[model samples]
Target: DLQQQALDSLVQHLADHHNAEALGVLCDVADAAAVERAMALTVERFGGIDVLVNNAGITHRSSFADTELAVFQRIMAVNYFGALHCTKAALPSLIARSGQIIVLSSLSGFAPLLYRSAYNSSKHALHGLFETLRYELKGSGVNVMLVCPGFTATDLRKNALVGDGSVAAQPPLAMGKVASPQDVAEAIYHGALKRRRLLVLSNVDWRARVLARFFPRLFERVLLPRLSGLKPQRAGRF
Candidate 1:
């Protein structure tokens, strides 16, 4: 629903600007056939795809101790496999057009917090996949970008699954406050236009990455202690 709304708003804006050349919005679940069909439709209509954004993702609030095997797989299916399916489907057209592929990662990918085993692992996997892909496709005229956002105000947490596979009412965030989704979107757009290698969505996230890099021991000893506490646990567990 959020992705559709975003795409609708984008297409409406394009139509308002009288850009008839802009491709109409196409949305599909991150399934193999769906992704393939969507990619085919985009190529058939637009003649080529210039930018492919793998933004379909989901979050779950569950620790490994109580997290069900199915729940973990569900999160991976949506967040990790979903992006992989879309990228693979879009690759042919992207390569043909010498276009760009942008993967929306998260601060968790850089620094894992508590109770986000699935989400953190998914983004970490994405970071690894795309970073390597970037190197492989370096001279092929295809650009790969990773955009990591700290915390954005969205209904993602509300949709997060708890340990027992129940919905988590409140989504814990890295920062107490979240930046607007529009702000992150704007940054993503700018980075794509400029062909930037990586785009960090917020200052806090940037600091976390820097701290993880320059002061690994201090970050693990100091920062991890606080962030790790945010993981959701049953009341009786502690």
Candidate 2:
């Protein structure tokens, strides 16, 4: 079923998305060797890498106290190190083409999300790493862009791991309006084309920025739970 889903997504992309030449490979991004192989295959298929979008990520929903070290490590490997591997593997081609690296981070990267310490930490690391890379490669022509999209319509929560590292069976509680995948894609497309440094999609992401900037303590105590599905009573524990 997993393989079928992957193949279906590929088939659908081939059917309705890019031209007949777009390719998809089912490689684990967390594996550095697999990432390198994927890059090699991409070069063989596409001739060169022009734009690299590191969108693969995983999430875990549990209190920090309940989260195990393995859970934290697994999340970091996917969300942070996965990007690192792909970027490193594709750097040569990217630099040669003056390409762009697009990172699909979350609002949690900048603003903490309750019960998602590992996820938050991973995204924050991505921001720091890529932002620094932007300056380091300033004259190299390779541009880096980090996208922070708020909660969107996706099966992310369904695939998220629980406290015991099992797949979350039920969807999380809905917070507010959710953005469609198509909408988020369009924003990313335009932002990448323009070589923008940061793409903050949706008002929810903007609200995270506003809260983090304007009201630090109040944001932590007040709005974080609202965004994170954390009940008000257990604020101090996490």
- Candidate 1's TM-score: 0.84
TM-score of each: 0.84, 0.91
lDDT of 2 by residue, 22-131 (tens): 66677888899989998999999889999999988889888899998899999999999999999999999999999999999988878888888888899999999999
Model 1 ranges off by over 4 Å: 1-28, 173-176, 225-238
Clash pairs, candidate 2, are none
* Predicted candidate 1 versus true structure: per-residue lDDT over 139-192, tens digit per residue: 889999999876777777657788877888776554545778888898889899
57: Cα error in model 1, Å: 1.0
On lDDT, the candidate that comes out on top is: 2
lDDT of 2 at 21: 59
Pairs with backbone N, CA or C atoms under 3 Å apart (clashes), candidate 1: none
- Find the 10 residues in a row with the least total lDDT in model 1: 229-238
Query: What overall lDDT goes with each candidate model?
Result: 0.78, 0.85
